[model samples]
Target: MIGAGMGAMAAAARLAVAGHRVVVYERTETYGGAVRRFERDGFGFDTGPGLLTLPAVYRDLFVKTGKEPLEDCVELVQVDPCARHVFADGTEVSLPNASRAGVVAALDKALGAGAGERWGAFLVRAREAWDRTRRPLLEEPLWPNWQVLAEKEPYPAVAHRRLLRTRQARTLSEIGSLELRDERLAALLESSALAHGLDPRTVPASAAVLPYMEHAFGTWYVHGGIRELARAVYERCVRRRVEFVFGAEVVRVLEKDGRAAGVELSDGAVAEADHVVADVDPAWLKALTDRPLDGNGDVRADPFMTRPGRFALLLALRGGCEAGAAHRTVVHAPDPESELDFLASADGDQPPPPTVTVLRPDDPALRPDDGHESVVLSAVVPSAADWDEEGMVRQYTEHLLEAAEAVIPGLRDRVLWQEVRTPDDTDDETGAFLGAVPAPALAAGRGRFLHPSNTTRLPGLYRVGGWSHPGGGLPHAGMSGALVAGLIVEGPEFRGSR
Candidate 1:
């Protein structure tokens, strides 16, 4: 395996248990890839994903790989009032975790009488999309006849008639306008996609599954930080006798008999293996081999090359977290269109204050003491932006701080110090091209949202991680590992996890 990411380590553990000697070569000094923790003084923050949704993916990993369950490895705390949404119109709603009825009631209470029912109705449809594509998109390998997935849009959109014409929502933006009539409700719907670096205006209606998945599974936080979950997985891999070589970068993939047989390290040393599983980004993987690993019909690297990355601010605040505070709060942008327009623009202009997510975990492990708190503020921005420019970073940071103030009372005065993480930082850490974060694969928009198959054209080569089948997100990446392991152990006949 090339890289010790969560997905790669997941595959390593399973492969080792299957009687295959697995070795992971990660360029970084540690594991977990983008799932990293930042520490200053005694304050710590999860710089990657703040919460875990559909944790069953990791739960299954532990159950299959060992006798111990996932709960024994790490404490999974379900966040109540899963999220607090502060909309553009000053409407606020605290959504209950995994409670359809509770969320509906909260929405009705906050956004007016019928808002909750409409949102609830949309989720019912979103669940249909989930059921239709869950197997092909998440549990199974990317089918060879993948075009079938492309041509079919699984979302059962409610139809509307206007001027003797009947129409159904095709894109997420259309779903917002046509179905979710309220602007606040639309913002709530679009924010889910936006969090994945997707443009709701153009993203397929199938993307509704994003919010549906979260609502159904509930949001969870691992104790100590999400990094603790990665640590547990790494420990499991070690227990399974999987070998890890950190700071050992694979410069090239060695081939023999037209198959990937091994990898060449940056130090010119070569390690041979029967199969090579890459956990890096597609673009980085392409650069590792001279052979055309993907054909014309395959999911190409060009489209993902410029995907948006995250800009995060880690704030060390002087005051303790407020009593009964929602763990996660989304502060919507004043002008959602301006933010979307800025993200779509290639000119790299100053972005309008973008929608920002403020995370204030109520865990004691994150802070030095009761007097100090660690807060993470993040927003989605173009990965191609000039993040290295101090002016750009400062301007964006100011915008984020301003937006966060809406949720965090006296946020400016409470901040003791702050660390900025831009796409450039993500690029340096994960080696993702331009620090781009990959969005989860969705079935629709002619399969434009789908990721490449885990099985590459190179016979002994396979892909595992967010960049491959099922695309990015904590759960999807874990599934990619499972699929890769299944394919390797059971051969081409493998039908994925049952």
Candidate 2:
């Protein structure tokens, strides 16, 4: 195995159970890749994703790998009133967890009269897209003739009567405008795509499944933070006797007789193995292989369509969290269009305050004491931003902090210290190019935006991680590991996890 991220660890655990001498070579000294923790002055914050959705992906891994389940390894708490969304029009809605009816009711009450029903009706179509793509996109490996999956838009979009001709909504933005009707409701729908670094204007309607997946599974936080989930997986790998070599950066993949034989490390040490499972990002993987990866024989240099990075503000405040606050609050941008445009632009145009996701886990383990609170403010920005400059980082950090005051009242006054992390930090940590964060795989129409196949061109080599098939996000990354292990253990005929 290569790299000790969640996907690599997951593949290691499963392969270990199958009696493979799994050894993970990570460039960093730690196990988790981008899922890292920062601690200072008795306060801790998760530098990556703070919440987990579609946890069943991990549950299945635990059930299949060992005697104890995932819950036994890490405490999982479902966030009630999953998130609070403050719209541009001063409309605030507290969306409950895993409840469609509750969401509909809340939207209706908060937005307007028929707002809930419109959103509810849109979810029904989203459900169709989910069911249609679930088997092919999630459960099954990318097929040989995968163009069928890409060309077909499974989202049963409502035909809108605009003028003379009735046309079905194609893009996510079109669906939001034609079906959702209201601007605020459209923003609500667009948030799912924007969160994944996808542009609502271009992403196919299949992207609707993104929101459906979250609302269906419910957002959950590990007791300490999301980094704890990585710890649990690493611990499980240790219990199974999977060896981990830290700081062993793989320089090149040694090929023997047209197959991957082993890897040459940065320290000039060669570790030979029968098979090599790569958990690194796409660019890093290509550099190791020194060739285009085999994805139905048409692999591009950069497989990803949209590579957006996160700008995170880790704040240690002096006061405790209020009695009952939503675990996650999205301070929506006043001009959603302009914000999206700025995130889409490569040049550093000061975006009108980007939509910020403020995460404040109620877990006491995160803070020094009840008196202190650990809050994270994260916003999606262009990975091409000049984040290497201190002035740019400082300016954006302050902008996010100011926007966060909408939820965390008097945030500037209460802040004891702040740490800023840019895409450069992500690139340094995970080896991703330009520190670009990969979005979850979306079946963009016209055979566009689909992730590369897990089984690459090189024999005896496999791809497993956010940058591989099924794309980024916790559940997808975990599933990528499962798919890779299944292919190696059960051969190319393997469909997916049963």
Best by lDDT: 1
Overall lDDT per candidate, in order of appearance: 0.91, 0.87
Worst 10 residues of 2 by lDDT: 296-305
Clash pairs for candidate 2: none
Predicted structure 1, TM vs. truth: 0.98
Tens digit of lDDT per residue, candidate 2, span 28-100?
8898878999999999999999999999999999998999999999999999998999988888999999999
Model 1 residue 266 CA deviation (Å) reads 0.6
Clashes within 3 Å, all models in order: 0, 0
What lDDT score goes with residue 250 in model 1? 97
Steric clash pairs (candidate 1): none
RMSD of each: 1.3, 1.6
Badly placed stretches (over 4 Å) of model 2 are 161-166, 295-306
